[model samples]
Target: MSDFWLDLGFRANPYAVRALAPTADGRRLLVGRDDELAALTKRVRNSDLHPVLEGQNGVGKTSLVAVAAYVMSQDFKEGRSQQLFLPLGEPLQMKDDGSELIRDVYFAIAQAFIAHHDDLRAAGRRVPRVDDLETWLNAPTYRSSKGGGVSTPLGGGYATTGTGLNTGSAFTDSGFQTMLRRALQEAFPGNSGGFVGTLDNLELLDTSSSARRVLEEIRDPVLQLPGLRWVLCGARGIARSLANTPRLNGVLADPVDLLPVERRYIESLIDARVHVFSVDESGRANTPVNADGFGYIYDVSNENLRDTFGYAQDFALDHDPAFFLDSSPAEIENSLMAWVDNLAEKSARDVRLQGRMWRLLEDLATAGGTAAPGDHDAYGFNDRTHMRKNVVELERFDLAISSRDEVDGRRRSISLTSKGWLVHFAKKRDLLGQGALDLSMTNESPEV
Candidate 1:
C-alpha cells in the first residue's frame, strides 16, 4: 500500500486543539466574526469608549480580540494609524479591599506594554523605550497591611520604598494621567492615536464585588482620557448583570455578541482541515476519511465550531491512516458515544456538586429532554434556587440550553443538548447499569 497519509499536506494533526485555521499572509486567522471586527475597529478608531464582547465559552471571543490587534498592528506598520494594542491577559480575581484588583490591572497593562515593545524590537523595528515610562511602570505602587508588608510592584520588579505611589488611591490622580499621556507619546513617536487595551475573560469580575467596583471606576474616568479605548470580553451573563450599574450606563457602548458560526461555515471548516489530508496519487483530491459521517457529527455537535472540530478529530483518530481508509457509520456512532461518555466523566470530575448535576440531567432526560421551570420540585430540587444554580452549572458545561418564552406567562424552558441526552441515557443503560425510565408522558404536568 502507498503512503497515503504521507502524500497529504499537514505536518501534524490539523484538528488539534491548538491548531488555528490558516489565514492569508500578514492577516489574522479569525473565522465568523467579521461584523464584530468591523465594529471593534470603528469603535477603537472613532470614539473613546469601552466595548464589551459577550459570548459563550469556546465561542471565539479571545480570537476576535487577537484579530483586532493584528489588524491594528498592520495599520500601524503601514502608517495608516498609530493605535497600540495592549492585551491584558486575564481578568483579576475579586478582592475584598479592591486594592489588589486595581494594582493587578495596572501591573498587567504595564507588562503588556513591555511585551509589545519586545515584539517590535524582535521584528527589527526601531522603537526606543522611554525612561519615564519604564520608571513609572517598574515602581512599586502599594503596600499591604500584612506583617510581611507585601508590596505591589509594576512589571514584576520591586521598587524603592519611599518612591512608590499608593495604587489604592492613585488611579484618579492627575499626575498619573499626565505621566501616562507623555509615556504614550514617547512610546509611539509618530502615532497620534492612543492605545487600545483589551481585557479578555471579563466575566471573572462578575462574581466579585471588588473587581466590579474597580471596573466601574476604571470605565468612567479612563475612557474620558484622550485616545484610550477599553474592550472587555466576557459571557452574556456578565453583560446582563452589569446592565443596570448606574456608573456604567452611558460609559460602555452596547456589547458585541459573538454568535456561533453558520452551519455551512462550520462544515467548510471541517472540510478545510480534512482536505489537507485528502489528496490522491494522481494529484486529484478525494473526500477525506468518512465524509458521509460529517452530517451526523455536525448534528451531535449542535453546529458549535469547537465541538465540530473535536468530533472531526475523534473521527480522524479512529480511522488511522495505515489501517482504515474511512470510518463506517457504526464506527462513527461508537466514536461519538465514546466522546459523550468522556465528556460526562470529565464533567463529573470537575463539578464539585456532581451528585446534584447528575440528578438534574437525569430529571431532564426523564422529561423528554425538556423541562419547565415549574417542574423543579418534581425533580427533587429542594427549592427553585437550587434548581437555578444547577441550571447555571449545566449551562456552563454546555450540557443544557435554556430559553425564555411566554406560554400563558413568561417562563424559562430548559432542555438537554444532544450530548447531554446521550450521556444521560448511556449512563442509565451502560455506565451506571441503571434501567431506563419511561419518558413518553413527560410533557404532562407533574402533580405538586
Candidate 2:
C-alpha cells in the first residue's frame, strides 16, 4: 500500500515530530520562536553556564535546541565565532551511583567529536589529530553486564566496543576527563570555537539524593570548563524540583521558559507545513491546503504546533485529498472534536489518577472552566495538598492549564484546556455514560 503521507502529496511525513534528528540539517520547519531563539543563541555564545529550558510537553523544547545548534553551526561556517553544538543522543537516565549516567554522557560527547571531524574532512578542511581522537574514543572499555555488549562504529572508522571495562572505574580514572578534553580541543583545532553539549529530557533524572549528588559531581565541574556549555531541557516541574536542591544553587542559571506561540503564529505554521507538502503539475510548490481546514484545526488544537500538525495530518489521511481543498469548517470541527473525545476517554482510564481527574474536571466545568485555587474545597478536596496534586496531574496530562487569573491579577486559577472541555462536555451529555459526577450548571461551553 502507498504510504499515507505520500498519498497526501507530502515529500516526507512533515508531522513526524521526533526529537530533532542529530544528523538533520538545522533548517527546521519552525514557527513563532524568534525571541526564544535569539535569547538561546545569546546564552550559547556568551556564557558557559548550564541553562535549563522548561515548558509543557509539545511546546517545542527539542525544536528550539535544534535551531540553536543550527544557528551556532552557521556562526562557525560564516566566521562569526567557534562553538560546535553537540547534542546528546538522548537524555541521561537517572541512576543510583551516577556511573551509568556519566558513561553515557562521555560516549555522546565522543560521538559528537567524531561527527564534527567527519564533517570538517568532508568539507576539504584540515582536521588535525583526527586519528588520535578516533583511537581514544574507540579504545576498548569495560562495561557492566547491565550496559550490554553492543558495538557500533560511529563513522570515521572509529568503533565503540564493550570490552568489559568497569563502567565505574572507567569514569573514576583520573586521566579520562583530561583525555576527553584534549581530544575535543584537537577536533575543533583552535580557540575560535568550543563545544555546546545539548541535553534534552532532563526531567527523567531521579529525585533521589544519590542521583542528584552524582549529577552535581558530573555537571558542576563541566560548567567551569571554559570551552564547554551545557544546555539542559525538561518540563517546568523538574525545574522547580531542581531549584530547591541546595547543592545545585549556583550551578543552574535561571531557566528559559518556552511558552505557547500566539494563534496567528500557529496559523502561519500550518500554512508553512502545507506549502511544504503541496505541489503543482510542474512539480513546483503551490498554495497551502484549504484555509478553512487549517483554521478549524488551529481552533481545535488550541494553537499548539504539535497538535496542529498532527490533526492536519490525520485529517488528510481520513478523507480524500480533494475534499480537503474545500473542506467545511463544521465537518472538520466535528471530526476533530470526535478525535479529541476518544483521546480523552482513553486517557481518563489511567488507573492511578482516574477518580481525581474526573472530580477535578467536574469542578472546572461547574466554575465555567476557571476557578481559583481555593475552589477545590467546595469539590470535596478538603486541603490544598490533595488539590495541588490533582492539579499537577491535570497539568501533566495537558487536561488543565493553571495560570494567574487575568481579571484578578494576583490570584492563580485552574481551568479546563480545550481537550478537557470536550471530555467534560461529553460526560455531561451522557455520551460516555461513565457515571461521572455532573457538577456543571448548564450545557453551554465555558467562556474560556
Candidate 3:
C-alpha cells in the first residue's frame, strides 16, 4: 500500500507504537505531562529514595521518565541546575538471574559511557576508561554454565555467589560491580548526581514475592550504587507489594501513581505530534481520528496509550488514503467509530462468552479493568470457585487474564483483556443506545 501518512502531510506516522525517547524532539512530542514531569524531576534531583512509577501498562510511564531526564540534562546544560544526569537509552529490564542482570546492566552502562562521551567531556566530567570496559565486554570468556561461578575476561576465573565475588579481591561486591561504581564516579565527579537510569517491567515477574525477591537481590549490587539514580516502573500490583516489603524500606520511595492522560488533552496531544512530524512545520496536517473518535478508542483500550496509538494507526492504514483525504472531520469520526464497532462485534463472536462469563467481564470492566479475585463476591459471584470457572472460560477465550502475588499469601489479581474491554464497551454502547444505562449517565460516553 502507498504511504498514507505522507498523503496526510506527515513526514512519519505520529501514532507510531513506541514510547517517547529521551531526546529534544521526543520532549516536544510529549504533551500533558508537565505536572508529572515536574514531580518526577524533583524526585530524581532532591530525593534519596528511588522514584517508582506505577501505572497501568502503556500509560506512558517510560515516556514521562525519559522526558523528565532529558529536561533535567537541559537544565544542567544551561546552568539552571547543579548536576547533569544522562538518561540511558532504554530502561533496564529487571532480571531473575543475579549474575546475568549485573553483567547486562554493566554492559548497558558501558555503552552509555561511550554514547554520552561528548556530553561528559563538555561538562568537565571524566569519561571512564573505555579500553578496560571494551576489553572485558568483548572478552571470549564472559561467563560459564549457570551453576558455575562467573569467569572474567582477564581469565582470572572470577565468580560470584550470594555472598560476593570470590577472587583476588576481598571485597564483598564483585570487581565488575566496583568497576560500574567507579565509572559512575568518574562521569559525575563529586556529588553531581548520577545517571538517571530506570528498571522497568517489574510486573513481568508475575508475582509480588518474586518481584520483591529480585529487587532485594539487586539492592546491594545495583540499587545501592552511589552514582546511579533509579526510577522503577511497574504495572499490576508489583509496585504495591514492593512498597510494603520491609526489605525494601528506606530504599524505594512511595510510587508516583500515573493516571491516564485526560481525554480533554487529546487534541493538544495530537496537534503537538502533528506539528512535530509534519512535512512542513506551518503546513496543515490531516489527523483522521477526531478527538471524540480517538477518545472512544482510548477509553475502550482502558486508556492504554500504546494500544490506543496502535489502533489508530491500524485503522488509518486499513482504509484507503482517500477515505481520510476526502472526508470531513465528523465523517471521519463516524467511520472510525463504525470500524471499532465492527471490531467489537467480531470480538463478541470470537469469545462467544456465556451469560455468566459476560457478567464477570462486565464486573471486571466496572472495577476499572483490574480487581482482586475476592472481588467476585461483590460481582454477585457465589464464591471463588464459581468466579474461577467463569474467569477460566474468559481466559480460554483470551478475554480475561489473571495474576497471583505472594503478598498477603497469594492475592488473586485479575484484569480484563483488551478484547474484554472492547466486549464490555460494545455492550455499554448498545445499552446506551437503548437508554437503559444508569451509571455514568453523562452526555459523554464513559471510560469503561
Candidate 4:
C-alpha cells in the first residue's frame, strides 16, 4: 500500500488581485464607508451643489459614488427619482457636437423614471408605468431617431439640440424641460416628495471645451431642479477645470469634496467588503480578518521599504553599529528582509498582487511629487517626467505615494500603517491572514 499526502496549507497564490466581484452575495455588493455613504445619502437629502467625490485613486470613489446612486434609487422610490448613470467617455465619443451627451442624459433619466413606474407596478401599486401613462405623461418625447433637435415627453414642443422637451414620439432639441417638470409632478402627484436622481462621471465625456460646456449645461440645471438630485463622480482635475467656467461657476457651484476614505471609515468599509464576501446568508464574517492581504502587501511593503530605506540611508553615513546592535540596525535589517521576503513569497504563491501593487504605486504617485501644472490631470506616469501612470490606475485603490531619489541616495517617500494596509488589503483581496502578522523587526530572515 502506498500513502499519498498533499500539503493543503500551500495554495498557489493567484498573483493577480481578485477581479472585483460584481455582486455582494446574491445582491449587489456594497463595501466599506458607512460615514461617507451616510454623508452622500445626506447630500441626496439636502445639498444642491451635486455631491462630488475626489480621491487620489483606488480609494473606491467611483464605487462609493455609484453606491450612492443605487441607494437613492432604492430609498427615494416615492420621490420618483430616476438614477441617470452616464459614463463621460461613451457620450463624448458619440456626440462630438455635445448634443449627444444632453440627449443621452435626458433619455437615461426618462428611462429611470420609466423603470420606477415598472417597480411600482411590480409591487401591485396602481400607478401607471411610464409606458402606460404616456398618454398623460407623454412618452414619445425622447425617442427621436433624427439625431437632431430636442423634443421631450410632452410632445409637440421645440428645444435646442441638447436641451429640450419630448414632443410625443419624436426626438427634438426643444421643450424637454416642460415635459420633464410635468412628468416629475405627475409621477409624484404634487406632494409625496418624490425625486429624480442622476449619477454621471462628468470627466469621462467632456475633457475638452465642447464637452465641458455640455456637462455644465446638462449638470448645472439638473443641480437646481427642485426634486432632482445629481451625484456626479469625477477626477479632481475635471472639477478644477470646470471651476472657472462662467456658466457652471454658480449653477453647478463647488462640489462637496468626497474625500478619500479615512482609516477608521475604511475599516468600516473593509468590514462591509467582508460581509459582502461572506459565505453566510447575511454576507458577513463571524470573525472578520483585520485586513485584506494584497492591500497589506502593498502597504507593508511601502512602509517597510520607505522606512527601512530611510533608516538605512539616514544612518548609512553615520554607520552607528551601536544602533543596529541596540535597536535601529537590527530593526532595519529585520524589517527590510521581512518585507522583501514576503514580496518574494507572495510572488511565489502567485497571489493576486494588483491591489497591493496598486496601493503601493498609488501612494508613491501621489505623495509629494511635482508634475508640470499641465500634467496633473493625466492618469499615467511619464518616466522622463518622473511620473508613473500605473500608479494612477492603482490610485483608484487609494494607495499611492510621491517620492524623489535625492542626491544623498535617500529616497523620501510616504507609506500607510501596517494596520491600515492590512485592513485595506483584506477588504480588497477578500482574504484574511490565518493569524496575526508579526510586524516587529527582528534579525532573522523573513520566512512565510
Candidate 5:
C-alpha cells in the first residue's frame, strides 16, 4: 500500500474519505467553506445557545465544525479572540440512554483537558478538578501512586475507593457532576469560554421524537453545563426538529442548513487536496483523477464530497494506476463516464419497477431533484396514494428518501439519492440513449 501511493507521488491517498481534522493541514485542505467557517465561528463566539446544523449526509458537516473550532482555538490562543474555545478532539456520538450520554460528555471533557493540559496551563487556565478527572482517565494507559479520600455520596454515605491511583472513586455520576462543575467554573470563569464540543448524527436515534426526549432529559445536566459550547448536527430534518422542541427552547440555536459546495469550487477542492497530500519535492503529484474527472464524480454524488472521494479512490484502486497516469485527458474522461454509467446500470437493474416508474424518476430529477410528497400532480402522479406507493418503492431501492414535518403534518420533503443522480446524469448526457447503461429492466435506484 505504501509503495502504491508512493509511486503515485503521494505520501498517502489524497482522496480518502474522512472528516477533515482540527489541525493546520485539515484547515489548509478545507476549501470553499469560508462563509460557513466564519458564520460558525461568529455563532459560537456570540451565542449562548448551541448551534444546530442540518445538512444532507456526507455534506462536510463534521469537517466544517472541526475547522471552525480549530480556527477559534488558534484565534484565542494568539490573542485574536477574547473568548478561549478549545475544540474537543471529535464529535461525541449521541446515545440512547441519558445517563450514558452525560457520562460521555464528561469523559470527552476529561480527555480534552488531558490532551491540552500544557496549553491550558500556559494560558493560566489551570483546572485542578479537571486535572484530577484527567488523571483518572489516564489510568489504563499508566498508573501513579497518587491517592485521595473518598468523595461523599449524594445519598449521604461514603463513596467507593481504590486506595491508590483509583479509577472508580471519582467516576461516579455525582462525582463527575461535582468535579465538572468545579472544572467549568475554574476554567471558564463565568462564560469566558469553554471546550467547543459537538454531538453528531441525531438522526440515527431512529426517530426525531427519541432525539428530542434524549436531549430534553439531559438538557439541565448537559446542555446547561457551564464552560461548554456545543454544535449538534443531524441530517433529514432531524436538527430542525430538535430546534423546534418546545421543551428545549432557547437551548438550541437556529439550524444551520448546509448545502452542497457550490459547483464553481469543486475543482479547487480537488486541486487543494492534491497539493496538500503531495509527497514529491517539486510538488508534482500523480493524481489519478483531475479536476474535471472529480466534477463528474461530484455530480454523480450530488455534490457530496465524501461520496466523490470514495468513488475516486475506489476507481484508482480497482484498475491499474498507469491508466490514469499514462492516459490522455480524453481517455480518462471516457473511462470515468463508462465506469459510472456501468455502476448506474447495475443499480438500475436492482430497482424493481414494472410500470411507468421510469417516467416518475425522470420527472423527479427534472423538478430539481426534490419535491414535497403532496405535490404528486407535479411529479406526474394521478393521486397522492399512487405517488406514495412509488415513493416507498423508490426508497426501498435506495433511490429516494423522504422527511416529514411533524408540527404541520402536511409538509414533507423527498429528494433523489446519489444513485438516482447517476441515472439522471445518464439520461441528461445521452449515456442512456447511447446504450452505455441498460436501464430497460428498472427505472432508477436510490439510497434511503
Candidate 6:
C-alpha cells in the first residue's frame, strides 16, 4: 500500500512507538552510556564500595544502570545479579524518622528479592526461594487488620512452640534486621561469589529511618561479602543528603554523578534514527519518486534537531564535547531555554500542533527521547487524537500529505519538516530576542 493513503488512526504511530533500541541492558532504546556503563560494571564486579549513579532527571542514569545489570547477568553465568528497582519518588511520611524508614527499606528490598525469585533460583544461588524471603521480609509490627490500620503481632518476634508453630507471628525490629542480613548474605555469598544490584530512585525514602539503615547495613564492613556489590541510581539531591548521613558516608562518598547524555552520543542516537527511518531492518534505503533526492526524513520542530543532533553526535565522537566547546552551564541553559520558549509558542498557536510538540518536549525532558506511544500519554501528555492531527498538519506542511485525515481511519505518522525546524528556530529566536522581535506579533499565526 502507498504511504500516503494508509488509514493512520487504525495504524500505530512509528514516532510514537519510537525508543532508542535496547543495548546490553535488555532495552532496545538505550543510547549513549558507554563510560557510565563501564564504570558501573567495574564498581559492581570489583568493589565493596557502593557506587551510586547520580544525575538530574532525564540524564539516562537508570537506563545506564539497567544496561550494566543486564550485562553482568549475561557475562557472568555463575555471578547472577538481580535488579531491585526501587522507584521511590514520593517521600514517605516523616522524612527523618530512622527506624520507621529502616522498616520501609527492608520491605522494599525484600520485595525486589521476591519479585525476581525465579531468576535467582535458576542461577544456582543458595538464597532462600522467594516465598520464604517474602515471609521473612513482612514485619510483625504491621498486619492488615479488619480496620484500615495494621495490627501488631501478639508476642511478636517469637514463635509459640508450646503447641503448633504460630504462623501469624511477626518478626521484631531486631528479627527483621537479622532476616535482612541473612537474605543479603545468602544472595551475595560472602567472599564466595559476585552479585550486582542496581537500585534506582533513593530519594523517595527522604526522612524514613528504615531507608538509611538499609544503606548502613548493606555498606557495613561486617556485612561485606566479596561478590556482593551495589550500584544506586538516583537524583543528586538523594546522593547529596545520603553523603551527609554518617551511616551512608562510606556508601555514597564515592559516586558517579551522571550529566546529560553527551551530545555526540545524542547525535549518534539521531543518526541511528535517521538510518532507521530511511532504511528497512535489513539496512536498504527506501526508494521513491525523483523529488527530494532521498526517501522520507522528518525534521520535526526543526529548531533544535540539528543542534540536539550535533550535541549528541559531538559527545559520541569525542566523549567530552564540553572540553572542546568551553561553554558554561549558563550558555547551555540559554540555548536550551530558547528552544523551550519556541516550543511553548508553537504549542500555544496550533492547538493540535502545540499538544504533540509539547508532548515531545516533555518526553525529551523527562525520559531522554520520545517514548513508545502508549508510554507518552502515561507520562502525562496528549492523547492519540492530538498526535494524529499534529502528524497530518506537519506532513501537510511539506506537501507530504495532500489533505487532512478528518476521517476516523487514516494511517499517518509525524516527521518534523525542514520548515518545521525553521519554526522551531523562529520560536527559539523569538524567545532569545527580547526586544528584537515585536511582542505585538504574539496574537498572529506564525506565518513566515
Candidate 1 colliding pairs: none
lDDT of each: 0.52, 0.56, 0.75, 0.40, 0.74, 0.42
On residues 334-399, what C-alpha lDDT tens digit does candidate 1 reach at each position?
665665566544433332325556667767766555565666777776666667777887887576
Give the alpha carbon lDDT tens digit for every residue of 1-448 in model 4. 2111101111211111222221232124343456677887666555445555543334445555555545654554444443322111111122344545555655555555665556544433333235432532453333333345544234334333342245423343344545565555554442333443434444444343544656655653354454455555544245555554676665454655554433333344445444544455464332211333223333443323222222223222233333333454345455544544443334323222343343333343345222322342342333323234433433333333333222211111223333234344443443423321222112322211
Error (Å) of candidate 5 at residue 302 is: 1.4
- What TM-score would each prediction reach against the true structure? 0.61, 0.70, 0.86, 0.49, 0.85, 0.47
Worst 10 residues of 5 by lDDT: 152-161
Question: Please, what are the lDDT tens digits per residue for candidate 6 over residues 269-302?
Answer: 5334434444245423311111111111112322
Model 3, 1-448: lDDT tens digits are 6677898888998888788889898898788888999999998888889999888888999899889889999999999998888887688887776556766666677777877878888888776555544655565433322344544332333343222333223222345565557668767766696788889888877888778888898888788877788899987657877875788999999987899998789888887878888898794788877567778899889888888998999898888878888888888888898889887766665445545556667777877987776675687766666767777888887877777553542343677778777778777766222222332232432212
| Sort by TM-score, top down from the best | 3, 5, 2, 1, 4, 6
Off by over 4 Å in 6: 1-28, 78-101, 132-174, 192-228, 234-247, 270-342, 346-428, 431-448
Residue pairs with colliding backbones in model 2 are 82-193, 141-165, 142-164, 142-165, 143-165
For candidate 6, give the lDDT: 0.42
Q: Which candidate is the best by TM-score?
A: 3
Model 1 CA lDDT for position 374: 64
Alpha carbon deviation, residue 350, candidate 2 (Å): 8.5
RMSD of 4: 15.0
Model 4, 90: alpha-carbon shift in Å?
13
lDDT-sorted candidate list, best first: 3, 5, 2, 1, 6, 4
The TM-score of candidate 4 is 0.49
Candidate 1 wrong stretches, greater than 4 Å: 1-9, 18-28, 79-98, 118-182, 185-191, 205-211, 220-228, 271-295, 314-321, 324-433, 436-448
* Tens digits of lDDT, candidate 5, 1-448: 4376777888888998999999998898789999989999889888999998888788999999999888988998889977788888788888888778887887787788777777777778855544445556655621222334454211112243333423433344235566556677777886578888889988667467778889998899789888888999887666765686798998999898898889899778878888888896566987888889999888777788888999888888877767767888898888887888877666565555533666677778777566665687776667667777877877787878775544422333567888777766655555453232444445544411
Worst 10 residues of 2 by lDDT: 439-448
User: What global local distance difference test value does model 4 have?
Assistant: 0.40
